[model samples]
Target: MPILIVEDDNFYAQRLKEVLMDFGLEATLVNSTQEALSSNIPLYAAAIIDIMLPNDPDITGISLRESRAGYLSGVALARRFRQKVPNFPIILFSGYFGSFEGESWARDNGILFFSKEDGPGALKYCLQKIGIIREVKPRVFIVHGHDEHALIELKDYIQNTLNWQKPIVLRDEPSSGRTIVEKFEDFASSVDYVFVLMTPDDIVRNVKEDDKRRSRQNVIFELGFFYGQFGRKSGRVIVLHKGPIELPSDIQGIIWIDISKGIKESSGDIRRELKI
Candidate 1:
């Protein structure tokens, strides 16, 4: 099923949308409980419903930790949906309380309740159970030179601020770190995206010598490795030049988003670009 997302608050709903994209499923945003109840959600594979609605009057229940309603509101919602749609898989979410009575309620009603505290992990768990698996984010590899700081900042933005899943080769898993030759061997063909920061520092430092080509050699090797590895799949690579080094013909074909000059506004820019 597709994923229908019902969130009362605008910001929370938007955040859930980004998480869904990573799973290759886009969420349908319904603002109010009325909108959610009125609309047809069957087109979706699953749904994310915020239990505590603004106009909903189950005030007797405790408040949710993140929002105003607590465990009780979620339980009521879960119970209500289960009675109406017995077969449909429904996800109940609450930001209010850590102890979600929703799970017990869901078990009774044959629905699933996820705590907001678990964050994406909860969503990931839910997706896994439903058998949706694959990498939706562009696997980006940044070959750093002296200006590694800029790359790191951008990486952080992508991971932390942007909430994008970046499998950083060095940072994420260093133990399995293979030689540069091994890393780029199969990379180009499999990689959907690549960014080459052809800055003066990167190029000048990586310059080749007869016996010892330093930083320049490293950059060249990685680029060449991708060129060859990608082989027929070379069109997916993105080559970003920092100063002026021309991309080889193979990689030159791919489209690129240049962050060499730097992003004008990080948080807002990314959110706007991705429509978070």
Candidate 2:
């Protein structure tokens, strides 16, 4: 896996680079915000960024979820790549942590957020984001709850039945214990499209537990991290709702996922959602 370390400090940046190399990964170190952007790196499994780069931008690159400028910062630019090319992970690091901005405003404009001073915290977060599986199977997390057999069956259909690339199904494995926000960074960094594997059970579980509140919160807070750090959008998000849903409060209202009734019917829906 390749990790892009974005920091202006040679000592710290080099230190991080060496760590990644020692751990069987490639590291590309850059010392300035300008240089980081100019690289136009095609894709990266993870990125370690300095949240407070001297002249990076006034707007929160570490918390952008949506964009009005369409194209703003290098981090913001990464979103375009993420939609077309998923699996690229991004880490927004800073020696300091900052407070969040407006909720609705942050959602429409922010995605992911992080602080750099966690003591290799950024690096650790990056590694976890790109789950280090032993094999080379295409990693795909079936985002459903317990007893999501339909999802499992759908997965089998896609792989064993349809002869599609077999994806490493995401279950309650120890690795999945990592925070979803961190995982999204990895997915955004590396995967092309996140199959939102939703089902009636998922909707039921989320709705019963006020998942709408949580999902909305996730969109604003977590999504802001990606928006600010990697610049992702709702367009890049391919949603598969088990049932109809309301745009939760805040920016969740901006992105819409089409709903489907069953497994077989859902497959084509996702294809259409991604416009594949």
Candidate 3:
């Protein structure tokens, strides 16, 4: 009933839906050209169509079980849709936009072309150009330990100061009958960035040294999870180290702000890293 999306990859399609939701828009998702053609196109405002798609046997009458020609079926689908409605809004969203053969055709026919690499902000901008109102917010996941005060301050900064959506704190979220890991993942996978709080919440001593202050084990694990998911160089993971906490040696070069004094002290660096 909002935007009709035609994407073949399930993972990418779900991610696109999440991004649209973050933009305060709802989307009806269809997996193939056949599905899109069958939908009530007139009821939707616009369509975000993936350029590379598998052949829909229902429409093409040819099986693409072992064929590569179906890769461009989205182009043919767009052509058919254009014929049906000349002025209908359409966006050709693709991961391979640079190498797509129909780039010129899409431009010539007045279709909006967007690359997956350009990210959700650009996609929202494209929809806006087509007269769709979008309210965008950064989805942030905060990974903290027993530092309740620190967590509250961080959330306040993100919500009240930065004016973004409420930052996700796993423990404070409703479980919804899911295991802790499942609940954590449900929030983690959708967030655009992760803020790890390295607070001195635990004291541990190894055989080689005296007891040292460290973050809770759970915090350490969650930090590793985010690092593994987004990688250290992506700038998606921000570490706020508080005090002289014992950090894992393997993650030495990760970008971190010394929040040992306070979150306000590192507010400038936080904004700069988040690119707000």
Candidate 4:
């Protein structure tokens, strides 16, 4: 069922609709309380009512000046909706702050109240809590070093082959006031899975003075960090190597996909493991 959005402001209403669409929800927009009251409430999964709405002549027996000032029109609509479909999810929002009375009424009537200044993310969270919309899509963090070509290919595979949205790719240069490690940790926390591209980017001197090729220290650090967050056995972390590279002894048993085999085959394996 589509969500019903009652707002007088066309721009704000369209913005709210777009936000809901981002969460994979369908929404119906109406500008007036009269239209909202006349709408088929049962067809809507939920209602997002703006506190202030344009006065409509069809809405009789209500003082528009007092009702609009107090934002009682939305409350009356909610009550009417309850009479029709009890326990229906209703969210009341307003751009005008300082509506303690309106908020109290909404709380008493089991409706959520949010200020426009709180932004759509706050409203989205409330909708998620009430089970009106699904949670945001799972994200995969792509950890790479100097191999931009391989990183791009792997990102494309995740988006095209695995049907996942854009993977997280950190900037080459760190932003001001935040260390590289801090940025990686912040990004990792938001993602459900991490994909490490262990391309041969750095060479190090071994104990015997022989040159050893390896992925960048940053890549290794991020891989270990995600492993610590998700655990090795959880299968939420994946490593793909372009060529032979040295790995720590602690990660000996962890599986690593060889992209040298072919991007198609390697992406397929990763996709299956991700269940996408």
Using TM-score as the measure, which candidate wins? 3
Query: What is the C-alpha local distance difference test score of each model?
Result: 0.54, 0.48, 0.78, 0.76
The order by descending lDDT is 3, 4, 1, 2
Model 1 bad stretches (over 4 Å): 57-71, 132-276
lDDT of 4 by residue, 158-248 (tens): 7887677688888843556788767765666666568888888888887887787799988888887776555465467888888767776
Task: Give lDDT: candidate 2, residue 239.
Answer: 44
RMSD of each: 18.0, 10.6, 8.6, 13.0
Please give the TM-score that candidate 3 achieves against the real structure: 0.57
Candidate 1's TM-score reads 0.41
Model 2, range 1-276, lDDT digits (tens) per residue? 577777777897888788677668788887655566556566566666654343334433423333323122334444533554464555544453232221223244333334343234334434643563122323343444343665676578557744546543433333566685565555444432244443333232454466431233333343444344423443434444545444435555443444444556556655565454
Question: Higher TM-score: candidate 2 or 3?
Answer: 3
Backbone clash numbers for all candidates listed: 19, 33, 0, 0
lDDT of 3 at 149: 88
Q: TM per model? A: 0.41, 0.41, 0.57, 0.49
Is 1 or 3 the stronger prediction by TM-score? 3
Candidate 3: global Cα-lDDT? Answer: 0.78
Count of clashing pairs, candidate 4: 0
Decreasing TM-score order of the candidates? 3, 4, 2, 1
